[model samples]
Target: MSIPLALQNEKFANCQESIKILYLVDDNFRCMCDDYNITKENVEFFKQKTEEDFQCRMEYETLSIELEEEILRYIAERTDQ
Candidate 1:
């Protein structure tokens, strides 16, 4: 299975196995991973744009962080069960 960009972070590097399991079995977690990847890509795209796009980049960055945290929380909750 392909690794999601969100799971490539040091914060989640150790949770690969758990992530794979949850990703396959949980729709919400899967959606969060997809959203995280998309937001991450948007952040990278805006990083190359003009200063006018700085705000947009920052917004995406913030959303990306939120999504990352939510994904982590979900994984933790699931794995603890």
Candidate 2:
């Protein structure tokens, strides 16, 4: 199976399988993963900008963190099932 973009983070490395399973079975989780990956890509793109884009980068970074937390929470909830 192809790895989900959100699972590319080292933080989620160990739980990739679990998250992938949830990604396949849950629509909401799949959406969150998609959002997370997009936000992550935005962060990377912003990182290449000049100093004036620092705030934008920070904002994207914060959003990515929130998405990561939500993804983790969803995975935890499903794993406990």
Candidate 2 Cα outliers beyond 4 Å, as residue runs: 51-81
**Residue by residue across 1-81, what tens digits does model 1's lDDT show?**
575866788888788889989888899998899898899888877776756578788999999999999999999999974
Question: Per-residue lDDT tens digits of candidate 2, residues 1-81?
Answer: 455675678899888778979888888988888888888888877776755588778999999999999999999999984
Tell me each candidate's TM-score: 0.55, 0.55
For each candidate in the order shown, give its overall lDDT on alpha carbons: 0.85, 0.82
Task: Please give the TM-score that candidate 1 achieves against the real structure.
Answer: 0.55
Judged by lDDT, which candidate is best?
Answer: 1
Backbone clashes counted, model 2:
0
